[model samples]
Target: MHHADLFGPVDAGLPEGLVYRPDFVTAAEEAALIDHVAALPFAPFQFHGFEGNRRTVSFGMEYKFDGSGLKQAEPFPGWLLPVRDHAAALAELKPEDFVHALIIEYAPGAGIGWHRDRPVFGDVVGVSLGAEAPLRFRLKEGSKWRRFTLPAEPRSAYLLRGPARTEWEHSLAPVSALRYSITLRTLRAA
Candidate 1:
Protein backbone atom coordinates (compact mmCIF):
# COMPACT_ATOMS: atom_id res chain seq x y z
CA MET A 1 0.00 0.00 0.00
CA HIS A 2 1.18 3.52 -0.80
CA HIS A 3 1.73 5.91 2.11
CA ALA A 4 0.23 9.37 1.80
CA ASP A 5 1.54 12.44 3.63
CA LEU A 6 -1.92 13.93 3.69
CA PHE A 7 -1.11 17.05 5.70
CA GLY A 8 1.94 19.14 6.57
CA PRO A 9 2.83 20.99 9.78
CA VAL A 10 0.94 24.28 9.29
CA ASP A 11 -2.44 22.64 8.55
CA ALA A 12 -2.23 19.80 11.07
CA GLY A 13 -5.83 19.95 12.41
CA LEU A 14 -5.62 19.17 16.11
CA PRO A 15 -7.67 20.93 18.76
CA GLU A 16 -5.13 19.88 21.41
CA GLY A 17 -2.28 21.22 19.24
CA LEU A 18 -1.41 17.71 17.93
CA VAL A 19 -0.22 16.70 14.45
CA TYR A 20 -1.88 14.14 12.17
CA ARG A 21 -0.01 11.91 9.73
CA PRO A 22 -2.36 9.77 7.61
CA ASP A 23 0.40 7.57 6.26
CA PHE A 24 1.67 6.39 9.63
CA VAL A 25 0.50 2.80 8.99
CA THR A 26 0.07 0.75 5.83
CA ALA A 27 -3.11 -1.11 4.83
CA ALA A 28 -1.53 -4.55 4.44
CA GLU A 29 -0.15 -4.52 7.94
CA GLU A 30 -3.52 -3.47 9.32
CA ALA A 31 -5.15 -6.77 8.33
CA ALA A 32 -2.34 -8.90 9.70
CA LEU A 33 -2.13 -6.96 12.92
CA ILE A 34 -5.83 -7.22 13.54
CA ASP A 35 -5.68 -10.97 13.00
CA HIS A 36 -2.83 -11.24 15.45
CA VAL A 37 -4.61 -9.15 18.02
CA ALA A 38 -7.79 -11.14 17.62
CA ALA A 39 -5.94 -14.38 18.35
CA LEU A 40 -4.65 -12.87 21.58
CA PRO A 41 -6.48 -13.54 24.83
CA PHE A 42 -9.54 -11.44 25.61
CA ALA A 43 -8.02 -10.24 28.87
CA PRO A 44 -5.28 -8.09 27.32
CA PHE A 45 -7.63 -6.58 24.70
CA GLN A 46 -11.10 -6.99 26.11
CA PHE A 47 -13.54 -4.09 26.05
CA HIS A 48 -14.57 -3.01 29.51
CA GLY A 49 -17.80 -1.10 29.91
CA PHE A 50 -18.38 0.59 33.20
CA GLU A 51 -21.76 0.92 34.89
CA GLY A 52 -24.92 -0.31 33.20
CA ASN A 53 -24.64 2.25 30.46
CA ARG A 54 -24.31 1.02 26.87
CA ARG A 55 -21.99 3.82 25.80
CA THR A 56 -19.10 3.59 28.23
CA VAL A 57 -16.42 1.41 26.65
CA SER A 58 -12.63 1.04 26.70
CA PHE A 59 -10.00 -1.50 25.54
CA GLY A 60 -6.21 -1.52 25.73
CA MET A 61 -3.06 -3.39 26.79
CA GLU A 62 -0.60 -1.85 29.25
CA TYR A 63 3.13 -2.66 29.21
CA LYS A 64 5.62 -1.69 31.90
CA PHE A 65 9.20 -1.01 30.87
CA ASP A 66 12.47 -2.22 32.39
CA GLY A 67 15.04 0.17 33.84
CA SER A 68 16.19 1.24 30.37
CA GLY A 69 12.62 1.31 29.04
CA LEU A 70 14.01 -0.57 26.07
CA LYS A 71 12.68 -3.98 27.11
CA GLN A 72 9.27 -4.68 28.57
CA ALA A 73 7.40 -7.81 29.63
CA GLU A 74 3.79 -7.83 28.53
CA PRO A 75 1.86 -10.96 27.50
CA PHE A 76 1.40 -9.47 24.03
CA PRO A 77 4.34 -10.67 21.92
CA GLY A 78 6.21 -8.46 19.43
CA TRP A 79 4.62 -5.38 20.98
CA LEU A 80 7.85 -4.21 22.60
CA LEU A 81 10.00 -4.72 19.55
CA PRO A 82 8.44 -1.90 17.56
CA VAL A 83 8.75 0.52 20.44
CA ARG A 84 12.41 -0.39 20.84
CA ASP A 85 13.06 0.11 17.14
CA HIS A 86 11.14 3.38 17.08
CA ALA A 87 13.17 4.70 19.98
CA ALA A 88 16.39 3.86 18.16
CA ALA A 89 15.25 5.45 14.90
CA LEU A 90 14.41 8.83 16.33
CA ALA A 91 17.15 11.12 17.53
CA GLU A 92 16.82 12.76 20.93
CA LEU A 93 14.19 10.15 21.78
CA LYS A 94 15.08 7.50 24.36
CA PRO A 95 13.34 4.66 26.14
CA GLU A 96 11.45 5.99 29.12
CA ASP A 97 9.80 3.83 31.83
CA PHE A 98 6.56 5.17 30.53
CA VAL A 99 6.55 3.56 27.08
CA HIS A 100 3.07 3.06 25.60
CA ALA A 101 -0.11 0.98 25.48
CA LEU A 102 -1.90 -0.58 22.52
CA ILE A 103 -5.58 0.35 22.53
CA ILE A 104 -8.18 -0.98 20.10
CA GLU A 105 -11.61 0.56 20.21
CA TYR A 106 -14.95 -0.64 18.90
CA ALA A 107 -17.52 2.10 18.49
CA PRO A 108 -20.13 0.17 16.60
CA GLY A 109 -23.29 2.27 16.46
CA ALA A 110 -21.94 5.45 18.10
CA GLY A 111 -18.46 6.82 18.70
CA ILE A 112 -16.60 7.79 21.85
CA GLY A 113 -17.43 10.73 24.06
CA TRP A 114 -15.21 13.81 23.84
CA HIS A 115 -12.46 13.78 26.42
CA ARG A 116 -8.81 14.73 26.72
CA ASP A 117 -6.31 11.94 27.32
CA ARG A 118 -4.95 11.67 30.83
CA PRO A 119 -1.86 13.85 31.30
CA VAL A 120 -0.45 11.50 33.96
CA PHE A 121 0.96 9.30 31.17
CA GLY A 122 2.73 12.12 29.33
CA ASP A 123 2.74 12.35 25.50
CA VAL A 124 0.37 10.02 23.59
CA VAL A 125 1.11 8.39 20.25
CA GLY A 126 -1.32 6.25 18.20
CA VAL A 127 -1.72 4.26 15.01
CA SER A 128 -5.05 3.72 13.30
CA LEU A 129 -6.14 0.27 12.15
CA GLY A 130 -9.33 -1.40 10.84
CA ALA A 131 -12.14 0.92 9.62
CA GLU A 132 -12.03 4.54 8.59
CA ALA A 133 -13.17 6.51 11.62
CA PRO A 134 -13.44 10.27 11.84
CA LEU A 135 -11.84 11.98 14.86
CA ARG A 136 -12.99 15.44 15.89
CA PHE A 137 -11.21 17.82 18.22
CA ARG A 138 -12.85 20.69 20.05
CA LEU A 139 -10.90 23.90 20.37
CA LYS A 140 -10.78 25.65 23.69
CA GLU A 141 -13.27 28.52 23.93
CA GLY A 142 -14.11 28.07 20.27
CA SER A 143 -17.27 26.73 18.62
CA LYS A 144 -15.49 25.16 15.70
CA TRP A 145 -14.32 21.53 15.88
CA ARG A 146 -11.31 20.38 13.86
CA ARG A 147 -12.16 16.95 12.49
CA PHE A 148 -9.82 14.29 11.03
CA THR A 149 -10.88 11.14 9.16
CA LEU A 150 -8.18 8.61 10.11
CA PRO A 151 -7.48 5.75 7.71
CA ALA A 152 -7.94 2.32 9.28
CA GLU A 153 -4.78 1.05 7.64
CA PRO A 154 -2.12 -0.72 9.74
CA ARG A 155 1.54 0.01 10.54
CA SER A 156 1.05 3.81 10.41
CA ALA A 157 2.09 6.01 13.34
CA TYR A 158 0.73 9.39 14.56
CA LEU A 159 2.43 11.62 17.09
CA LEU A 160 0.56 14.08 19.32
CA ARG A 161 2.62 16.73 21.13
CA GLY A 162 2.69 20.45 21.85
CA PRO A 163 -0.67 22.33 21.74
CA ALA A 164 -2.56 19.35 20.32
CA ARG A 165 -0.91 17.50 23.12
CA THR A 166 -2.56 19.50 25.90
CA GLU A 167 -5.52 21.59 24.79
CA TRP A 168 -7.80 19.57 22.54
CA GLU A 169 -10.40 16.89 23.23
CA HIS A 170 -10.70 14.02 20.73
CA SER A 171 -13.38 11.41 19.89
CA LEU A 172 -14.36 9.08 17.07
CA ALA A 173 -17.61 8.50 15.11
CA PRO A 174 -19.62 5.30 14.60
CA VAL A 175 -18.63 2.81 11.93
CA SER A 176 -20.17 -0.31 10.35
CA ALA A 177 -17.20 -2.53 11.16
CA LEU A 178 -15.01 -2.67 14.27
CA ARG A 179 -12.82 0.35 15.05
CA TYR A 180 -9.28 -0.44 16.09
CA SER A 181 -6.33 1.74 17.23
CA ILE A 182 -2.88 1.30 18.78
CA THR A 183 -1.76 4.03 21.20
CA LEU A 184 1.65 4.46 22.83
CA ARG A 185 2.21 6.50 25.98
CA THR A 186 4.83 6.72 28.74
CA LEU A 187 3.31 6.04 32.14
CA ARG A 188 4.50 8.10 35.06
CA ALA A 189 5.77 6.24 38.09
CA ALA A 190 3.51 6.19 41.08
Candidate 2:
Protein backbone atom coordinates (compact mmCIF):
# COMPACT_ATOMS: atom_id res chain seq x y z
CA MET A 1 0.00 0.00 0.00
CA HIS A 2 1.06 3.57 -0.58
CA HIS A 3 2.48 5.31 2.46
CA ALA A 4 0.03 8.18 2.13
CA ASP A 5 -2.90 5.77 2.22
CA LEU A 6 -1.52 4.17 5.35
CA PHE A 7 -1.27 7.37 7.35
CA GLY A 8 -4.12 9.47 5.99
CA PRO A 9 -4.37 13.14 7.08
CA VAL A 10 -2.15 14.90 9.55
CA ASP A 11 -4.23 16.21 12.40
CA ALA A 12 -4.38 19.98 12.56
CA GLY A 13 -4.86 19.80 16.30
CA LEU A 14 -1.49 18.23 16.96
CA PRO A 15 0.65 20.28 19.31
CA GLU A 16 3.19 22.78 18.10
CA GLY A 17 6.63 21.61 16.94
CA LEU A 18 5.57 18.11 15.96
CA VAL A 19 6.31 16.47 12.62
CA TYR A 20 5.10 13.09 11.46
CA ARG A 21 6.28 11.67 8.18
CA PRO A 22 5.05 8.32 7.03
CA ASP A 23 7.15 6.07 4.80
CA PHE A 24 10.34 7.72 5.92
CA VAL A 25 12.07 4.58 4.66
CA THR A 26 11.25 2.08 1.93
CA ALA A 27 10.27 -1.50 2.74
CA ALA A 28 13.72 -2.74 1.81
CA GLU A 29 15.44 -0.25 4.08
CA GLU A 30 13.08 -1.01 6.92
CA ALA A 31 13.75 -4.73 6.57
CA ALA A 32 17.49 -4.21 6.64
CA LEU A 33 17.29 -2.00 9.71
CA ILE A 34 15.15 -4.53 11.50
CA ASP A 35 17.68 -7.25 10.73
CA HIS A 36 20.52 -5.13 12.03
CA VAL A 37 18.65 -4.35 15.24
CA ALA A 38 17.80 -8.01 15.75
CA ALA A 39 21.49 -8.91 15.57
CA LEU A 40 22.40 -6.46 18.32
CA PRO A 41 22.26 -7.41 21.98
CA PHE A 42 19.52 -5.56 23.88
CA ALA A 43 19.31 -5.22 27.63
CA PRO A 44 16.11 -4.56 29.52
CA PHE A 45 15.50 -0.80 29.73
CA GLN A 46 16.59 0.49 33.13
CA PHE A 47 15.31 3.95 33.90
CA HIS A 48 13.29 6.22 36.25
CA GLY A 49 14.50 4.06 39.13
CA PHE A 50 12.99 0.84 37.76
CA GLU A 51 13.48 -1.69 35.01
CA GLY A 52 11.06 -1.95 32.11
CA ASN A 53 9.89 -4.62 29.69
CA ARG A 54 11.36 -2.93 26.61
CA ARG A 55 14.88 -3.87 25.66
CA THR A 56 17.16 -0.99 24.71
CA VAL A 57 20.70 -0.05 23.77
CA SER A 58 22.31 3.21 22.73
CA PHE A 59 24.48 4.64 20.00
CA GLY A 60 26.21 8.04 19.81
CA MET A 61 25.78 8.25 23.59
CA GLU A 62 24.62 5.66 26.06
CA TYR A 63 21.99 6.87 28.53
CA LYS A 64 21.51 5.67 32.09
CA PHE A 65 18.83 6.92 34.42
CA ASP A 66 19.59 6.14 38.00
CA GLY A 67 16.98 6.99 40.64
CA SER A 68 18.32 10.52 40.83
CA GLY A 69 18.62 11.43 37.15
CA LEU A 70 19.92 10.65 33.67
CA LYS A 71 23.61 10.32 32.87
CA GLN A 72 25.70 9.62 29.81
CA ALA A 73 27.81 6.48 29.78
CA GLU A 74 29.95 5.21 26.88
CA PRO A 75 30.20 6.95 23.52
CA PHE A 76 27.77 6.01 20.77
CA PRO A 77 28.77 3.00 18.69
CA GLY A 78 30.59 3.71 15.44
CA TRP A 79 28.32 1.25 13.64
CA LEU A 80 25.38 3.63 14.01
CA LEU A 81 26.89 6.54 12.11
CA PRO A 82 24.83 5.91 8.97
CA VAL A 83 21.59 5.79 10.90
CA ARG A 84 22.46 8.96 12.80
CA ASP A 85 23.14 10.78 9.57
CA HIS A 86 19.91 9.61 7.98
CA ALA A 87 17.83 10.61 10.97
CA ALA A 88 19.50 14.01 11.18
CA ALA A 89 18.79 14.73 7.52
CA LEU A 90 15.19 13.62 7.83
CA ALA A 91 14.62 15.81 10.86
CA GLU A 92 16.30 18.83 9.22
CA LEU A 93 18.80 18.87 12.03
CA LYS A 94 22.53 19.23 11.69
CA PRO A 95 24.44 15.95 11.97
CA GLU A 96 26.53 17.26 14.85
CA ASP A 97 23.39 18.41 16.65
CA PHE A 98 22.37 14.84 17.30
CA VAL A 99 24.65 13.24 19.85
CA HIS A 100 22.64 10.29 21.10
CA ALA A 101 20.44 7.45 19.95
CA LEU A 102 18.37 5.09 22.05
CA ILE A 103 17.28 1.97 20.18
CA ILE A 104 14.32 0.30 21.82
CA GLU A 105 12.56 -2.99 21.04
CA TYR A 106 9.09 -3.53 22.35
CA ALA A 107 7.19 -6.81 22.50
CA PRO A 108 3.44 -7.28 22.03
CA GLY A 109 2.55 -6.39 25.61
CA ALA A 110 5.02 -3.57 26.08
CA GLY A 111 4.25 0.13 26.10
CA ILE A 112 5.99 3.25 27.37
CA GLY A 113 4.53 5.40 30.07
CA TRP A 114 3.73 9.09 29.58
CA HIS A 115 6.80 11.25 30.15
CA ARG A 116 8.89 13.96 28.62
CA ASP A 117 12.33 13.28 27.25
CA ARG A 118 15.14 14.36 29.55
CA PRO A 119 15.69 18.12 29.60
CA VAL A 120 19.30 17.58 28.69
CA PHE A 121 18.20 16.45 25.24
CA GLY A 122 17.22 18.87 22.51
CA ASP A 123 14.98 18.02 19.54
CA VAL A 124 13.90 14.37 19.36
CA VAL A 125 13.39 12.29 16.22
CA GLY A 126 12.38 8.66 16.01
CA VAL A 127 11.95 6.11 13.23
CA SER A 128 9.43 3.34 13.61
CA LEU A 129 9.85 -0.16 12.19
CA GLY A 130 8.17 -3.58 12.31
CA ALA A 131 4.74 -2.51 13.65
CA GLU A 132 2.26 0.35 13.90
CA ALA A 133 1.43 1.80 17.29
CA PRO A 134 -0.50 4.70 18.71
CA LEU A 135 1.63 7.54 20.11
CA ARG A 136 -0.37 9.58 22.55
CA PHE A 137 0.29 13.00 24.00
CA ARG A 138 -1.00 14.87 26.99
CA LEU A 139 -0.50 18.37 28.39
CA LYS A 140 -1.53 19.75 31.71
CA GLU A 141 -4.00 22.61 31.69
CA GLY A 142 -5.55 24.68 34.45
CA SER A 143 -7.33 21.82 36.10
CA LYS A 144 -7.47 19.29 33.31
CA TRP A 145 -5.33 17.67 30.67
CA ARG A 146 -5.59 17.98 26.90
CA ARG A 147 -4.76 14.89 24.90
CA PHE A 148 -4.04 13.76 21.35
CA THR A 149 -3.07 10.55 19.56
CA LEU A 150 -0.92 9.91 16.53
CA PRO A 151 -0.30 6.59 14.85
CA ALA A 152 3.39 5.75 14.57
CA GLU A 153 3.22 3.55 11.51
CA PRO A 154 5.87 1.22 10.21
CA ARG A 155 8.59 2.99 8.21
CA SER A 156 7.42 6.32 9.54
CA ALA A 157 9.39 8.97 11.37
CA TYR A 158 8.36 11.57 13.93
CA LEU A 159 10.08 14.67 15.25
CA LEU A 160 9.38 16.59 18.40
CA ARG A 161 10.74 20.02 19.19
CA GLY A 162 9.75 23.21 21.06
CA PRO A 163 6.62 22.68 23.13
CA ALA A 164 6.10 19.20 21.77
CA ARG A 165 9.48 18.25 23.16
CA THR A 166 9.33 20.05 26.48
CA GLU A 167 5.81 20.91 27.63
CA TRP A 168 3.95 17.80 26.56
CA GLU A 169 4.35 14.19 27.59
CA HIS A 170 4.16 11.35 25.08
CA SER A 171 3.54 7.61 25.44
CA LEU A 172 2.75 4.51 23.42
CA ALA A 173 0.14 1.90 24.15
CA PRO A 174 0.84 -1.83 24.30
CA VAL A 175 1.80 -2.91 20.82
CA SER A 176 0.10 -5.88 19.20
CA ALA A 177 3.29 -7.05 17.50
CA LEU A 178 7.01 -6.60 17.82
CA ARG A 179 8.12 -3.01 17.19
CA TYR A 180 11.44 -1.28 16.98
CA SER A 181 12.25 2.41 17.34
CA ILE A 182 15.48 4.31 16.82
CA THR A 183 15.23 7.56 18.74
CA LEU A 184 17.82 10.26 18.04
CA ARG A 185 18.32 13.36 20.14
CA THR A 186 20.57 16.40 20.24
CA LEU A 187 22.23 17.46 23.43
CA ARG A 188 20.61 20.57 24.89
CA ALA A 189 22.90 23.55 25.17
CA ALA A 190 23.87 24.67 28.64
Candidate 3:
Protein backbone atom coordinates (compact mmCIF):
# COMPACT_ATOMS: atom_id res chain seq x y z
CA MET A 1 0.00 0.00 0.00
CA HIS A 2 1.30 3.44 -0.90
CA HIS A 3 1.14 6.02 1.88
CA ALA A 4 1.36 9.10 -0.29
CA ASP A 5 0.05 12.25 1.37
CA LEU A 6 0.08 14.62 4.32
CA PHE A 7 0.26 12.57 7.50
CA GLY A 8 -2.51 11.45 9.86
CA PRO A 9 -2.54 7.77 10.75
CA VAL A 10 -0.76 6.33 7.75
CA ASP A 11 -0.51 2.62 6.97
CA ALA A 12 2.55 2.67 9.22
CA GLY A 13 0.61 4.66 11.85
CA LEU A 14 2.90 7.65 11.78
CA PRO A 15 1.93 11.13 12.93
CA GLU A 16 2.14 14.62 11.42
CA GLY A 17 3.54 15.66 8.06
CA LEU A 18 5.34 12.43 7.23
CA VAL A 19 4.43 12.01 3.58
CA TYR A 20 5.38 9.09 1.38
CA ARG A 21 5.05 8.21 -2.30
CA PRO A 22 5.86 4.77 -3.50
CA ASP A 23 6.90 4.57 -7.17
CA PHE A 24 8.03 8.18 -7.23
CA VAL A 25 10.25 7.34 -10.18
CA THR A 26 9.87 5.04 -13.14
CA ALA A 27 11.92 1.87 -13.39
CA ALA A 28 14.00 3.34 -16.19
CA GLU A 29 14.66 6.45 -14.15
CA GLU A 30 15.69 4.42 -11.17
CA ALA A 31 18.11 2.40 -13.24
CA ALA A 32 19.62 5.51 -14.81
CA LEU A 33 20.02 7.12 -11.41
CA ILE A 34 21.65 4.05 -9.92
CA ASP A 35 24.19 4.04 -12.73
CA HIS A 36 24.95 7.72 -12.22
CA VAL A 37 25.14 7.33 -8.47
CA ALA A 38 27.63 4.49 -8.80
CA ALA A 39 29.91 6.77 -10.77
CA LEU A 40 29.98 9.70 -8.36
CA PRO A 41 32.91 10.00 -5.97
CA PHE A 42 31.59 9.73 -2.41
CA ALA A 43 33.20 10.29 0.96
CA PRO A 44 32.39 8.49 4.17
CA PHE A 45 29.92 10.33 6.36
CA GLN A 46 31.84 11.96 9.22
CA PHE A 47 30.59 13.25 12.52
CA HIS A 48 33.13 14.45 15.09
CA GLY A 49 35.90 12.53 13.32
CA PHE A 50 34.02 9.24 13.47
CA GLU A 51 33.24 7.91 9.99
CA GLY A 52 30.08 6.05 9.17
CA ASN A 53 29.84 3.10 6.80
CA ARG A 54 27.56 4.76 4.25
CA ARG A 55 29.21 7.17 1.82
CA THR A 56 27.69 10.38 0.46
CA VAL A 57 28.07 13.09 -2.16
CA SER A 58 26.60 16.48 -1.32
CA PHE A 59 25.57 19.21 -3.74
CA GLY A 60 24.21 22.73 -3.44
CA MET A 61 25.26 22.92 0.25
CA GLU A 62 27.28 20.58 2.41
CA TYR A 63 26.97 20.17 6.16
CA LYS A 64 29.89 21.21 8.32
CA PHE A 65 30.78 18.24 10.50
CA ASP A 66 31.72 20.63 13.35
CA GLY A 67 28.01 21.53 13.62
CA SER A 68 28.71 25.16 12.90
CA GLY A 69 26.35 25.15 9.84
CA LEU A 70 26.14 24.36 6.11
CA LYS A 71 28.59 25.52 3.46
CA GLN A 72 28.40 25.60 -0.33
CA ALA A 73 29.67 22.44 -1.99
CA GLU A 74 29.33 21.54 -5.65
CA PRO A 75 26.39 23.17 -7.42
CA PHE A 76 23.28 21.08 -7.86
CA PRO A 77 23.54 19.03 -11.04
CA GLY A 78 20.99 19.38 -13.84
CA TRP A 79 20.69 15.63 -14.41
CA LEU A 80 18.79 15.26 -11.15
CA LEU A 81 16.10 17.82 -11.91
CA PRO A 82 13.49 15.25 -12.84
CA VAL A 83 13.84 13.38 -9.56
CA ARG A 84 13.92 16.62 -7.58
CA ASP A 85 10.65 17.71 -9.12
CA HIS A 86 8.88 14.64 -7.81
CA ALA A 87 10.32 15.16 -4.33
CA ALA A 88 9.44 18.84 -4.27
CA ALA A 89 5.89 18.10 -5.36
CA LEU A 90 5.47 15.66 -2.50
CA ALA A 91 6.46 18.41 -0.06
CA GLU A 92 4.32 21.00 -1.85
CA LEU A 93 7.35 23.10 -2.66
CA LYS A 94 9.18 24.12 -5.81
CA PRO A 95 12.26 22.20 -6.78
CA GLU A 96 14.30 25.38 -6.82
CA ASP A 97 13.36 26.01 -3.22
CA PHE A 98 15.49 23.09 -2.15
CA VAL A 99 19.03 24.34 -1.58
CA HIS A 100 20.74 21.17 -0.38
CA ALA A 101 20.94 17.76 -2.03
CA LEU A 102 22.65 14.54 -0.96
CA ILE A 103 23.22 11.27 -2.77
CA ILE A 104 24.07 8.48 -0.37
CA GLU A 105 25.25 4.97 -1.20
CA TYR A 106 24.58 2.37 1.45
CA ALA A 107 26.62 -0.73 0.84
CA PRO A 108 25.61 -4.06 2.29
CA GLY A 109 25.27 -3.83 6.08
CA ALA A 110 25.28 -0.05 5.91
CA GLY A 111 22.61 2.25 7.25
CA ILE A 112 22.33 5.68 8.81
CA GLY A 113 21.99 6.29 12.54
CA TRP A 114 19.10 8.16 14.14
CA HIS A 115 19.06 11.92 13.76
CA ARG A 116 16.86 14.75 12.61
CA ASP A 117 17.77 17.25 9.93
CA ARG A 118 19.45 20.43 11.13
CA PRO A 119 17.29 23.38 12.19
CA VAL A 120 18.74 25.36 9.33
CA PHE A 121 16.71 23.11 7.03
CA GLY A 122 12.95 23.23 6.74
CA ASP A 123 11.43 20.22 5.02
CA VAL A 124 13.28 16.94 4.37
CA VAL A 125 12.59 15.18 1.05
CA GLY A 126 14.22 11.85 0.32
CA VAL A 127 13.93 9.36 -2.54
CA SER A 128 14.92 5.78 -1.87
CA LEU A 129 16.53 3.72 -4.58
CA GLY A 130 18.04 0.25 -5.19
CA ALA A 131 16.73 -1.72 -2.18
CA GLU A 132 14.22 -2.11 0.58
CA ALA A 133 14.84 -1.06 4.16
CA PRO A 134 12.93 -0.03 7.25
CA LEU A 135 12.87 3.71 7.80
CA ARG A 136 12.21 4.16 11.48
CA PHE A 137 11.04 7.23 13.31
CA ARG A 138 10.81 7.79 17.04
CA LEU A 139 9.71 10.39 19.58
CA LYS A 140 10.13 10.62 23.32
CA GLU A 141 6.87 11.21 25.12
CA GLY A 142 6.94 11.49 28.87
CA SER A 143 9.10 8.51 29.87
CA LYS A 144 8.51 6.36 26.80
CA TRP A 145 9.20 6.33 23.09
CA ARG A 146 6.59 6.34 20.35
CA ARG A 147 7.87 4.74 17.19
CA PHE A 148 6.89 3.82 13.63
CA THR A 149 8.58 2.11 10.72
CA LEU A 150 7.90 2.62 7.04
CA PRO A 151 9.12 0.22 4.41
CA ALA A 152 11.35 2.41 2.31
CA GLU A 153 11.26 0.54 -0.95
CA PRO A 154 13.02 1.32 -4.19
CA ARG A 155 11.49 4.19 -6.22
CA SER A 156 9.79 5.63 -3.17
CA ALA A 157 10.01 9.19 -1.92
CA TYR A 158 9.21 10.51 1.55
CA LEU A 159 8.97 13.94 3.08
CA LEU A 160 9.49 14.95 6.69
CA ARG A 161 8.00 18.24 7.73
CA GLY A 162 6.26 19.91 10.70
CA PRO A 163 6.46 17.55 13.66
CA ALA A 164 8.02 14.74 11.67
CA ARG A 165 10.87 17.00 10.68
CA THR A 166 11.43 18.73 14.02
CA GLU A 167 10.07 16.48 16.74
CA TRP A 168 10.92 12.99 15.50
CA GLU A 169 14.31 11.44 14.89
CA HIS A 170 14.53 8.95 12.04
CA SER A 171 17.06 6.30 11.06
CA LEU A 172 17.66 3.52 8.59
CA ALA A 173 18.48 0.31 10.42
CA PRO A 174 21.24 -1.68 8.69
CA VAL A 175 20.16 -3.41 5.50
CA SER A 176 21.29 -6.61 3.82
CA ALA A 177 21.42 -5.36 0.26
CA LEU A 178 22.95 -2.34 -1.42
CA ARG A 179 20.88 0.85 -1.56
CA TYR A 180 20.92 4.49 -2.57
CA SER A 181 18.97 7.55 -1.43
CA ILE A 182 18.72 11.05 -2.78
CA THR A 183 17.89 13.67 -0.18
CA LEU A 184 16.78 17.21 -0.94
CA ARG A 185 16.32 19.94 1.64
CA THR A 186 15.02 23.49 1.71
CA LEU A 187 16.72 26.13 3.82
CA ARG A 188 14.73 27.55 6.72
CA ALA A 189 13.66 31.08 6.02
CA ALA A 190 15.57 33.81 7.83
Best model per TM-score: 3
Candidate 3 lDDT: 0.87
Distance from true position, residue 80, model 1, in Å? 5.3
- Cα RMSD of all models vs. native, in order, equals 8.4, 5.4, 5.1
Worst 10 residues of 2 by lDDT: 3-12
Clashing pairs in 2: 60-76
Q: Candidate 2 — which residues are off by over 4 angstroms?
A: 1-12, 67-79
**Candidate 1: lDDT over CA atoms?**
0.52
Kindly list the per-residue Cα lDDT of model 1 for residues 1-190, writing each as its tens digit: 2222432122244344455555554566567767765554433222333321112112233422222323333542574455434532431255443355555556466466777666566566766666667665554445544444444344555566666657767676666666566666655347
Give the poorly placed runs of model 1, Cα more than 4 Å off: 1-16, 43-76, 83-92, 95-98, 142-156, 188-190
TM-score of each: 0.63, 0.87, 0.91
Better of 1 and 3 by TM-score: 3
lDDT of each: 0.52, 0.85, 0.87
lDDT accuracy of residue 119 in candidate 2: 86
Q: Give one digit per residue, the lDDT tens place, for model 2 in 1-190.
A: 7543453433449889899889988898899889988887899998766889899988767666765544555566665666678778877878778888889999999999999998888899989999999998878877766777898999999999999999999999999999999998998878
Error of 3 at 88 (Å): 1.6
How much is the lDDT of residue 140 in candidate 3? 81
Candidate maximizing lDDT: 3
